[model samples]
Target: MKTYLIATLAMAASAVAQPQKAETPSPEPSRPQMRAEQPAAPKPSRGAFDAMLYVSVQDPSMEWWFNVPEGFAPHISEIKKIFHNQEFSLFPFADNAKVKEGKFSISYSISMKSPDGSLTELVRGAKYEGTKVADDIMVACPDVIDFKLDGRFPEGLYKFFISAKDGISGEISEYENHIRLAEWSAPVPFTGKKLVSDYVRAFSLQPSPEALYSIVFSDDFDLEQKGAPNSLNYTYLGFMKAAFKKNMFLISHIRDSFKSLSDLNRAKFILILAILGEKGIDASALSEPEKRYQEQIRAFKLPDPYGKWDPFLGAAQIDMLWGEFFADGTYRPVRRILNILSHAKEAAFADELAEKSRAPKTQAEWDRYMLGRLYKAALKTVAINARKYPLVEQYCAWALLHGDIPEVSYEVLSPMLEHIREMKSPSGGESGENPKVRMPRIDVESL
Candidate 1:
């Protein structure tokens, strides 16, 4: 079967050490004004539901206009109700204290059931400064206040409305759905390899990360050698990169298509592969996250040429990649890799390049066929971790079938396969060191 894989880039954001398959970043522009034009935001899709809301808390001392009007105060509980799990503190009212005037930036972030939710709208507030006059809250309406949700949110684009009190006065105020309340959700549970396979087949996408690895181990491979040199040459960075990248797709599919299976199947499979691949590599390795961190360090050769604390930046990058990927499905790394693999000839490259190209590794590697091997490794990793990670196995099987590859075998790796078959827990849970895992190595020798 043509293996569909989410080939991970390095874990470290500043992976200066990874063997330089690409060239140095372009030189900084000489003119300051020329560089002043910051990078442009990704173009929104045609006919996409990209909504924005701005919230300005007017002064309590005055008419006390809120982002919403006084009539809608009853719904305040409903609005705040949705954000129960969020680490938010309700700013208490000081009797007659002045309302602080500032723009509350909230990003309306949308994602699929998977970690990689697809779209993020910057909900910007108008130039909101505290106005000493009554109805000062009017300034808040000019733009939207932005609060961004990081993970899977409830299934709906945030809705906006306004309600006001009927009194001697006109509408005291109005409250738009200024604060978008939504959560990021992981994929739901499903059972039976055949059933799961059928789901994937019907969907034409990968499963959740937790699902794929859970199943891959059932086939065959040596878990003991998972991270050993070229037995898989698997690194923590690779897994993280995959998760981060797939999230972009996951998030986009849900946001764009109303969480329709038909729209998200492809994205779902990719997310499952990327996440489970990371879990499998982590589960099989003895040192785990730390070991992975070290591998990235060795590969990239930390500090100096890469910059000080490149390893930290790299780790941050992994997390950040996940955040961005989950926030929107248009991140650069994963999409670029997927684009190449999707379009590349089946058996293109015969050997690694003898002469280096000045292109970046992402662009340079596009011409090479190593992506195929990387995809295979990602697949294998998912399988190996399936036993230890049910979510990984389930999702992998789901993704494989979705992609039209039926009946995968371990090729039979290690006892991990058997362990997965007999494993108990299906509810995917997060496992790994909290703060620090081993670092990864980047090969920056050529740089």
Candidate 2:
């Protein structure tokens, strides 16, 4: 009985020991093996984001930038004008945005759309708009779908849309751009077409080619042609101040530049002679004082004393070339050269020469006067042979389409023979007299 009890107690003890020992059964290799077979768990997706937004005129001379969530790269590609569905593709810049990590920097240059309404590929001096960098939170990062719009878009609806990719699931999440553009007064003043017309009307009384030429030569000139925002150049207020100064200068120099003030009063003398010469007036037709002047003119042939004037713009051309043609009177030599060109029988050749003969004058007055003469002479020459050459008339019409000037009568114009005669050569070298012009001074330090 004692032996039986001891054995039983030993068995109980063994069972108790087994329970307390905590059986570590060959440390299940299953868990480690399963872990080795499984792939990595994906990263978590970011939560929804919302931000502010706004839209404004885009400047072609600038690079625009936008900030977006890293996963929204696919959505940004959609925003591009040339969108292509591909992962990790670069976005095309619409405006002149120099994109660096989706950051923007702009350049100073004019850009205009071509005739077909496509953007000009290169920078120009006559079509750029002013640039502004927006540091506002909305402008900086517009990737959020719940973005609130700033500024009122009065004329049209302002819209935005966004899409993002789920990093872990590789699923796309679309967002309707909730931001709407609000219409707000621009910080910069707006100068419209009406203002420009008003300015032209107010100061057009005593015409100066300088004013007109300045308008055409402006760096932002192309915008004016396309009816773009005039504010792109400068404020109307700023323009008015400069115009006032130009107006004063034009008024002061009207007599010297527009009226007959240069050339020893020879231009006026020629004018009187041409008027008389057209009426077939001779030496005997003049009164006592006029006769003396006529005698001097006849002896001097003062219209073109140097023969250089005659060969290019001979006797007949000199007689009919309007005195107003040379507003400064010093450009008579150039006028004569142009007259010789007008006599060319081939209208195409004549126009080609005229296009090539751009005057080398920086002053608006000089350039305008020369261009005006060229325009007029070209028109008159075409009109002279209107019946035989219809294309000449069409060319003249095209030239007149873009400009306004006094109407000319073909009956009053000089004959072709006279035009030919004026294009003759003189005996010898002419006198050395430089016309008034501003020459560039070299900066020695630059060299």
**To one decimal, what is the Cα RMSD in angstroms of model 1 from the true structure?**
24.1
lDDT (tens digit, per residue) of candidate 1 on 287-394: 344345434533542112112212223232222322222222222322222222232231224122323433326643543434434434333443444444333344
TM-score of model 1 (CA atoms): 0.22
RMSD of 2: 35.9
Q: Candidate 2 on 51-91: residue-level lDDT in tens?
A: 11222112111111211111111111121111011011111
Residue-pair clashes per prediction, in order, are 110, 17
TM for every model, in the order presented, reads 0.22, 0.15
Off-target runs (Cα >4 Å) in candidate 1 are: 1-188, 193-328, 338-447
Error of 2 at 377 (Å): 9.9
Candidate 1 Cα deviation (angstroms), residue 348: 6.7
- Looking at model 1, report the run of 10 residues with the lowest lDDT sum: 88-97
Error of 2 at 32 (Å): 99
